[model samples]
Target: MPHQQTIERKTARTTTKFTGEVTCKGGSSRGIVKDLSAAGICFQLYFDINATTGQEVSIKSDEFGHLTGVVQWYRGDKIGIRLNVSSNTSAQISSYYKYFR
Candidate 1:
């Protein structure tokens, strides 16, 4: 028998253009999502929302609706967030990447 190798997909991401409203404890801002993945999201804020690492926030977008996540990192006004999602939401993210962008 031939040896079989296992393949793994850690996280799948897609580059997209969508406007989302981000709400955090500090404030809310209109952000443009640069990309989205099953594991995380990245966006650039137009206004200063004053978000920091580990801060929980929710984003409302027309394509994906509302998604909640914790801030993972940042560079200037752009931020990376690790998503807190159910299995359904994970599947939705994958589908969006597959079919849409």
Candidate 2:
């Protein structure tokens, strides 16, 4: 069997660990942002919550401020989000991670 690439990521991702807030459907939870990219982000919530693909979510952190995105996938306590911002905004957010790197 050959390894398959199930998801094709448009932008490169960088490892990061930061505490942030994730808001969805009137509920909010604390999550640890694990990895970030210009196009998407992956974070692990402190607790399990109801979240599904296409659900709208808002993420805020001291590093990236506020970002609006849609849930792309969720597994266990981890969730992935695809940002709704433009490339310019993505670039700005990516720049913030440089200091952490």
**lDDT at residue 11 of model 1 (Cα atoms):** 80
- Candidate maximizing TM-score: 2
Task: Report every candidate's CA lDDT.
Answer: 0.85, 0.86
The runs of at least 3 residues in candidate 1 whose Cα sits more than 4 Å from the true structure, single-residue gaps closed, are 1-9
Q: Write the per-residue lDDT of candidate 2 for residues 1-101, one digit (tens) a residue.
A: 99987977678898989999999984788989999988888989987668889999989988888888999999998999998988766666966867556
Provide the global lDDT of candidate 1 against the true structure: 0.85
How far is each candidate from the true structure, as Cα RMSD in Å? 7.0, 2.2
Native-to-model Cα distance after best TM-score fit, residue 55 in candidate 2, in Å: 0.3
